[model samples]
Target: MEKRLLGVIDATAFHEGLQELTLHRSPAAIPFGGRYRLIDFVLSNMVNSGIQSVAIFPKYQYRSLMDHLGSGRNWDLNRKRDGLFFFPSPRLDHPVTGVGPLDHFAANIDFFKRSEQEYTLITNACTIFNTHFFPVLEWHIASGCDITAIRKGGVSLGMYLLKTSLLRELIETRHETGYLSVRDAATDPNSPLSLCSYPYEGYAAMIDSVDTYFSASMDLFEPEVWNQLFPRERPILTKVKDEPPTRYAREAYVHNTMVANGGLIEGTVENSIIARGVKIGKGAVVRNCIIMQKSKIEENCIVEGAILDKDVKVERGAHIKASGKKPYVVRKGTVQGAWMNS
Candidate 1:
């Protein structure tokens, strides 16, 4: 079979909290687990699955994403038939707005229409996990699904596999009003037309048209429209278990070297990850904490269950306890919990 064209959508803002160290770069460019960029996981997954053609949709703060991706050479995506593409934001003359994923779908309709492939894979860049999308694609085709969305339990990872023809038709049929932010329109009831009120009703409409919708949450497409379209259990629902309990945040870093002058390293680190250029002063104990680059942990300080961002300085004799989705940083003797800059 001819390989299907795959497009990865890395729709994450670099400015999200605790993302400054990596935000100056795209989230995709943020360093993770010691060496690999977050984008590497997704791109590696795509390549390993045999999906040849890929395009990255980068929004603002994409300079780092571009610099790292660099013609997709690392992923071996620099070939003529199997090259990577960077889809820049549409120009003002083109005048596209509210350009969410679906809008990106509408905007790039031509790419799908002209491609020889029958299917497309769309995914986000926020989460860190390894997946073999070929199985999902196989499931999508074998089940005769027009659209298949991949979801994990509790959190929606924002991945989807769909038929190019069906997606194109949906975009065309919906026309200019095809896309809208659910958060924005949901907040304002007076908003003219939500994606809910559109020709397809909602995401379920598209999924129901298919044979199945797979998600870690069994009722992945359990939209209010479920009643309008089909009976309960009408659509084949499948649950995908977490491959290895996908974990994020800074706690993942521990026991790694931080390069810098006067870098004091005194800790018991085993299989832990750390960033570059961090200084652990003498008599300071760092156990299982992610220390970002250029952070200074002063002497006699005990840092346990904590994550420090770049340039954060811990005072002498200060103690830290980590408890929250956010990272902990000490700024000028004041300890506070905040999102780290990428």
Candidate 2:
């Protein structure tokens, strides 16, 4: 399947509800699971499924995305032959609706024409899952379906598998077909394409909004969810950051939390995910939060039901809490002083 299947990830779609987190970066580059970026999950899934030739289409603030991916060496995609390819949209001002827009693909049609892969797996960069697409490919071939959309419980997971030739046809004749994207073509009732759904009975979550993102992050605490996502055989890969193990101070107290490397814990933490290089000062109490990489919480602060983005600083004696409807999002690289407590 490595030689036969090609992976194309659409990283351009933006959700209005996630604006707080995506103000400075593309949605695909948003940090997740303490260490991995949002795109890492799907990209790793493709690599783990033996797809060597992968292409990423990104738009709107992709500098961070490029910085995170670099040469795709972390996922072992840097190769002399068909390796990782990146294509940014030529028209950044155009509005894109779905996962794989035909116009964007049309911009770089030569890539598809030159590729030797027999089939293509097009997916969104946001859905979190660990799936083997070879089985889906086999199912698509056996069923003689023109397009196969991977679904969980009858809901589309924004993943599709189809022939490379058919994808090219869709891209070239998009205006005539009146299909703006693969999603539009598959979901349209009047389309001539034979569409099928491959039911995936695995753990999958599409992070499109703040609520969904927070819910998925909290779900990582479950043992079953944790095992399903990070199994030993199909590990989720990410950029390598060499850091020492997290250090816990004598005054620190923690329980039921996931703390990444190079963090200093001096306060109390519960039911949270702490990323690398985070610091929790003495007398701070953090619970039900996702503290991103290099964020800090000073002494005597109380933070709960919040998401502190990368490099955020919570000043001393501050108290921040959610309203039980949505997690309080502290934007990236900002400071939360005591006067601004909520």
Candidate 3:
């Protein structure tokens, strides 16, 4: 069956360190893994899974995102049937008030209505992981599930797969009511139908749960709010294996290593993730960090848990680590442990 995956590029700066870097740009444009941008991970996953049509939802600060993801050329996403399309937020004439994933998805409800595919996969942009989505789609269909949420076991990677019809129903119901949280829809027994949580356990569990199926519950949301919806005997639980060694950066440094040119990396390092034209002096030790394009690191500098914006400089013997959790730069000969937010 023809299947289309909709990769939603949500632009919220969810991480403190990443938010600072994306002050001028969208989070999707944040550089990661030495060479690739954060959005590359999600986009690449879609491409690798043979999903041709993809739309990026850029809500705020999208210029850089637009620049990097130009026509989706880099990931072979440029074609007659396949290419990256940008979907902007609905205007006042459209008047979409609240902001949430469902709202964003509702704004682009027309895309779903027009799509010819039988299955649709919705994923967030910020998560960094590698998986072929076709299997997830297959599991969704085989289970006779109306909605199948793709969840990682240990830590939620925040992905899901739902039937096009179910998504349409959710959007329509929420649009009439002016609110939609996955927590609310999955629990209401009086609603259209129940949902199935596909536990991403080991290979056997993955196959069995897809075959047997289980009910979805409010466990997916905050515990305090559980009473707002109905409770189920045992909600479906998917066990997802640990993703690749992924890092989320708050304040970090990296130097002179090859980053695979896509995704996010957190923490500090020296002589690692160094793309072309990056220079680090002999005495410079970069610890817990991310370095982007052509940035230079100077000598005798002890840099710790800091993100060096492009072309940032640190002179000799400058010890720089900031506390208020913002990525800051240290000029020449400056020995400071904390920085004042300007």
Among the numbered candidates, top lDDT falls to 2
lDDT of 1: 0.50
* Tens-digit lDDT string for candidate 1 (1-342): 237756656443333343434435555565444334556656776776676788787766688678777877667778987578887556323332321244555576677677777787766655444555666777767776555556543233556666666556556755454343212222244534221211111232111100111111113223433332223322211111123221222322333332223233553333234555555655666764556555776666767645565567777767775555333433322343323231
Global local distance difference test of model 2 = 0.93
In candidate 1, which residue ranges exceed 4 Å CA deviation?
12-23, 90-100, 105-110, 153-155, 180-272, 277-279, 294-301, 311-326, 329-342
TM-score of each: 0.61, 0.98, 0.67
Can you write out model 2's per-residue Cα lDDT over 162-252, one digit (the tens) per residue?
9999999999999888889999988988778898999999999999998899999999999999999999989999999999999999989
Pairwise TM-score winner, candidates 2 and 3: 2
List where candidate 3 sits over 4 angstroms from the true fold: 1-8, 12-17, 91-100, 181-191, 201-256, 259-272, 321-342
TM-score, predicted candidate 2 vs. hidden true structure: 0.98
Worst 10 residues of 1 by lDDT: 205-214
Clash counts for all predictions = 17, 0, 31
Candidate 3's clash total is 31
Q: Root-mean-square deviation of each candidate, in angstroms?
A: 12.4, 1.0, 12.2
lDDT of candidate 3 over 246-334, digit per residue (tens): 34255445544444332333434553344333455556666545445555556566665455656565555667664554334432223
